[model samples]
Target: MIVTSAPRTKQILREVWRPLALLFVWDVVVTVVYFVLPFRAPSLPLTLFGSVLALFLGFRSNSAYQRWWEGRGLWGLMINASRNLARAARNFLPDGEAVDLKRTIVLRQIAYVHALRCQLRRQSPDQEVLRFLSRGEADFALARTNVANGIVDGTGRRIELARSKGWIDTIQQSSMERVLIDIANAQGGMERLKNTPLPVQYRLVPTLFTHIFCVLLPIGLVETLGVATPLGSTVAGLMFLAALAIGDDLVDPFANTVHDLPLNAMCRTIEIDLLQSIGDPAPDPAAPDKQGVLW
Candidate 1:
């Protein structure tokens, strides 16, 4: 989603600033209380709490990143599946109907990609998808609740028609069906990732721990650091908050943010590549400035 490297530093800083501000406020409060009150140094238990909190934050961040990476990888498999399906259609269809059937099936595959992208983003399927289907077909597809499913249904109809017309053998039809099944499975996997989220209770636990650790850090350092307890506390708080905020930011991969997978771009790629493979004119490449940086 986010394209250039130039914006990441600014983005991370913006994401980290809110928690850092809280940390600074906490530090100031602790410093003032240290001088005003007859408070002794924090005990060894406080130090251990801070260490454990840091480790917990690290683990949470890693888990969030893993989910994000896994989601992207699943979409990568979808792209490959779509391409392979088009190639198989081109290769297996009878010679007389090869060109037309190849173009039709490949275009339908492209439409499926676009529809799925829109579905994941929770956007309406647009006119762009209509370009791949006939007017009656497009209107019929629009009647369905799930545009992606409609695309798959249309693909199956076309394959069945081709078989009835003697354009492909039963064995070839089965092969194509297998490819379609793979595409369906890939879509299912993506939907699984999109619908199921990390448990809220699980997320909240580490968050509470991080805050508690930040609160106790000043007391732990007060004896040795004295007036510099605020600085030490601020440092520890910033580190903890950085980990938490980053983890929070990476947990959702299909929320249609700039940080999420470039599904639109990937769909366009499938469309152009499949068309080119069948001797059709390729669509214009997307603008260089708009290209996304893949993780």
Candidate 2:
């Protein structure tokens, strides 16, 4: 995600420059046509159109931002659930045989988060996930269609094993299982967001209306503004264009884009906390790039 307080002007210009340039050229052409021809000035109800268009853009932006925030909230839930599971395993499991089992469970929790991150991004988890698991276990998890869910299932079975061996009592096992359920619920929410998208009308209608307004902007204002029609119309149209871009950029939070959530950084955070809890050496915290983007 972009960690900067605000987006750089260069980036914004880059995204909109092509269309803005076209609009500027179109505005100039319209102004020239109006002055050269002896045609009557077209009177479009621009005020009414602008008001209705603003409402549509506003709704679209709000809906997209809600989806983005929900995705981040779900990840927050997963992070807490992961920590709780690791803490429970470290404390509840007995010493002796359970020592190795505790370490395995903690590491696997790290693997599970990474796998879920990769899964949400539609990436292969082989690099981020395999190193944390035993050869047999890794094969078992990777063989499944949903590698992250498989890891959670394996962890559940391991917890049950610890209970059967008397490493943890039934009550303690139940507590750990509750944490796993929370993790599952968070994963489900993320999946739903990634798979489902904002309705087509929300995406298509605002954009179409915005462009229509822009094309008609200079025509409607040419008689009043004269030579200044291009400048005034383009500026007003640019606002609506930028508003449309905001909704598009934020609609898919899981996408591998600067506007999307920093899933990689978040996964590394879980790794660091869980590893350090078990006295293992963990990687340093993730830092943003020179441009202040965290990935």
- Identify the leading candidate in terms of lDDT: 2
TM-score, one value per model: 0.89, 0.97
How well does candidate 1 score on lDDT at residue 34?
79
Predictions in order: lDDT: 0.78, 0.92
Top candidate by TM-score: 2
Off by over 4 Å in 2: none
lDDT of 1: 0.78
Clash pairs, model 2 backbone: none
Per residue, candidate 1 scores C-alpha lDDT tens digits across 1-295 of: 6767564666666887887777778777877787898977657586678677778778888888887898778788888888888888888886574567778888888878888888887888757678777777676567899888888888898899988988889999998888888888888888887888778765998999988777777767777677887787787777678788877877887777767776767777888888887888888655433444542
Pairs with steric clashes in candidate 1: 2-258
